[model samples]
Target: MDKITRIIAYAKTKLQEDLTGHGFDHAQRVATLAHQIAKKEKAQVDEITLLASAYLHDTIDDKVVPDVAEALAQLQMFLAEIEISAKQQAEIIFIITHMSFSKELEEKVTLSTAGKIVQDADRLEALGAMGILRTAYFGGSHQHPLYDPAIKPVVFTDKTEYRKGSTVINHFYEKLFLLPKKMNTKTAYEEALRRQKFMETFLTEFYQEWEPEKANFF
Candidate 1:
């Protein structure tokens, strides 16, 4: 209804069509999580901006944005059209660029509350049944295995190992499981618990499926 809200709706619809850990379904789920946490956090953060940030967080994701530099410039220009100020635009870009687990060790950047909210929202999607589905989808897309019993997730001694790390499942152990501890709000923390249990259950089932004795149980 409002100007920013309209920008958000249009941006989301477009990203949903072009982006994916699978598709728009994933974006909607993340957006819902953002709204849920936003409602529960009761922080002084702007709901419109926070929700907008969440919905568009992955607009320029490594997987989504084909030409990273060009996409980013286009993204900044797009935000300009929506009447967000330069500082507010910086806040949104800072959150998306710095909040990623993949790049967290590469660079340490400060976050705004809006950025934190979006970070929490996006990470939450990587933790539940939804998380499992997205991981398998992305892993399959990237030619990574569904699970690799031979290769255990390595504990990083440094960022290099973390960057060139193991399969996508390794990402769950290395990062998603650790996210709840990093949550900036009570709302995000509580949601993390439910999703964490979900990921745990998923790993158990996935491993079980690979074992001869448990293979047919499903």
Candidate 2:
């Protein structure tokens, strides 16, 4: 098999049983989106590195894997076995490690063009209709409340605070609503605006349904 095919096979195996939003399907979507964005962007980007990073991005995520260190070590070996060059491997590893939203909250991460494309693609997955479904799925899996007027969204000072006591609805306020402004590329930025508006409309309808009496007030 080709290197990319091999990487896809490995990723599918790793994410096969994930019930959370970060499953193999998510990876495939990100990979496809990354490729699309890369093609549209005028800036030069390493497509191979971006696609590989997209596919393998979550394999070593601490949230998904019990032994992050071990998983990363194995990933490094896989890259070597696939005969990826040192520079390409470095770029892929950097993108996968730093592309996370929680990590972005902790520190400012500067990425290469390839990294930027991959990050944009992954962020795109967290918007629009698919974004809504994924958020609901994650909330259900973690037993977070769907919505609560009494529990307002907190401005997260750190990853821990962000992860703590989160309701699904509040996630839009804290993250999804802000993603359009955070997009790295122009194409992605424009796409994000459409998705962001969709999310806002959905939220409005959701609240209306939740409290029909208050619907007329808005």
Candidate 3:
């Protein structure tokens, strides 16, 4: 019945059909992470805006929705219809639109503390065991190879370059491994580093499996 409840319902409906790991469950996890990060860091943030943005962040994402412009318009209309105030709507829209990694590739947009919290939460989701599975799932869905030593990881500086896609293993180097330094909050940063280390361990085993002869010799 409340505005945040309606926003969650809208996000769930929009993201439920996604198969690329950006589903409603992923959004819910991000919301939970945002809440935890804010509390751990003792940062004063607008909870309503943070939670709403976390839930809806991917609803209008180009990766999730076919027509991003249309989705954005529909989401704005829904917010207004649900009686959310203008200032809150603006904050929510700004956070969701600018918090994405692809968007950051284009330009480093300044965000509010709440936006930073949500951004950190989402980035954290892309770093650990969950991140590895999500990367593999997305690559499988997009027809990207699991690993191709022939095709090396790229240093992408733009959305076009980033979205062109790369091998699943290469994604760890290209994006996921670099997230720890980009974290905004100390809590998120520490956790990101821990997750990054776990991913490194995972990759070590993957390489050992991929090159069994090398492992056998050792």
**Which candidate comes out best when scored by lDDT?**
3
Q: Please, what's the RMSD in Å of model 1?
A: 2.8
Candidate 3, 1-218: lDDT as tens digits: 88888889999899998999999999999999999999998999888888999999999999888999999999999989998889999999999999988898887989999999999999999989999999999999889999988999989998987997989999999999988999999999999999999999999999999999989956
Candidate 2's C-alpha runs over 4 A off are 215-218
lDDT of each: 0.73, 0.90, 0.93
**lDDT head-to-head 1 vs 2, winner:** 2
Q: Write the per-residue lDDT of candidate 1 for residues 1-218, one digit (tens) a residue.
A: 67556756756665766523735566667667777777677757766567666666677776776777776787788788877778778777777778777677677676787777777878788777877777767766667765676888766656666645578777788777888887877888888898899789877876776685867774
- Candidate 3 yields a Cα-based lDDT of 0.93
User: Could you estimate the TM-score for every candidate?
Assistant: 0.85, 0.95, 0.97
The C-alpha stretches of model 3 lying farther than 4 A from their native spots are none
Q: Please list the residue runs of candidate 1 whose C-alpha ends up more than 4 Å from where it truly belongs after superposition.
A: 18-22, 156-165, 214-218
Q: State the lDDT at 209 in candidate 3.
A: 93
The sequence of per-residue lDDT tens digits that candidate 2 reaches over residues 23-91 is 999999999999988888866777679789999999998768889999999999999999999999999
Order of candidates by lDDT, top first? 3, 2, 1
Scored against the true structure, residue 47 in model 2 reaches a CA lDDT of 65
Selected candidate, larger lDDT, 1 vs 3: 3
